[model samples]
Target: MTGCGRREPIVTIDGPAGAGKSSAARELARRLGFRLLDTGAMYRGLAWAVQQAGIPPEDGAPLRDLLERTTVELAGDRVLVNGRDVTAEIRTPAIGELTSVLTALDPVRDKLTPLQRALAAAGGVVLEGRDTGSVVCPDADVKFYLDADIETRARRRRGELAARGVDVGLDRVREEVLRRDRQDMARSLAPLVRPPGAVLVDSTSLGPEAVLRRLLEEVERVRCCTPP
Candidate 1:
């Protein structure tokens, strides 16, 4: 919510993939009238660009070079890469896998983290990413670590792909989700972790609206406790 002359709250939603962080964050921002920052989409856009250029994910030097020349614009549900809209292109399962690998690299994180921080510098923003609470916005006014069981998470991801007209088997989606989870947790740079003081919400049996309601309650509680 806008604080007028006062400081607006910075909300960080960090979690594993497909745990409803993005959807909940979007709703949370809408209700609060704040900006929504989807950090994952930024990486996914870059992954699409790299893939389009036929660059190998393992090739750090070239990837970094491409990033330097690339202009990634994330605004209003659109992901623009070098002035071209790639919002739909970057949401595929293939780009997601590439994003997982590219995001783990120090060079990529080094380039993107500052951009994310700049976007949130003025506050009144809900940032959703693997390490947003732990690394990107450690001092955020309210932080939430949303999670669900692995099977539930995989199911959610599969449903999303199906809605996009991508016919993927449940077993394959589950295996891929597991693989990405392992990589995210094992990555040396900005690995996923529940930052201290972050509220944990399990959405295994809950819908997006329920999760948003719970998070809004947390925000109200934090606001009440803060000094005016």
Candidate 2:
């Protein structure tokens, strides 16, 4: 899909949490020589700021002023919140819960989606998020929806947390994953769904390398028909 009368290539990879979209998008961007935009990190940064400002997650509403003042920057692998590096800080399970809330609020979506659009306006980018293909970059040239079984996703989330020293049990992780999945799909705004025209890739048993190879094949197929 193309926007703003621009024809530059935009690739959107949307998926459920723990589906490996983030890691795959980073590698895809590098392999394709495109910019990488982790839209989830943007929400995480905003959630971090809101949490820092003592905002209550139970409010169930967007704090306009707090959001307006917040700035999220993605510099390679580092994520900056208001000029402070909060990359490692934003990945916590606590923040993950908060981010789910933040992404659900209409005001928050209104504030952040435009920033995401501007960043990818020039295209030649890989965007990974729950709604990147459906909402943020609907006109993206190529879109992929990566998915895996719930247990697989739970195990992956558990492994990730363990590596980060969080050490959450698989049962606890499974519960959280199911909870977030319900929240994401049931939310009024930007609910997770497979975007139209997106290629579905089930990674239930596929490794990251296999996923990347399949994605590359799709990109090559798209490139073949694109006018030079």
Give the poorly placed runs of model 1, Cα more than 4 Å off.
1-6
Write the residue-wise lDDT of candidate 1 on 9-62 in tens digits: 889999998799888998999999999999999999889989988988874778
Worst 10 residues of 1 by lDDT: 1-10
Q: List residue ranges in candidate 2 displaced over 4 A.
A: 1-8, 58-62
TM-score of 1: 0.94
lDDT top scorer: 2
lDDT of 2 by residue, 54-75 (tens): 9776444447778778888999
TM-score of 2: 0.95
lDDT of 1 at 54: 92
- The lDDT of model 2 is 0.89
Q: Each prediction's Cα lDDT score?
A: 0.88, 0.89
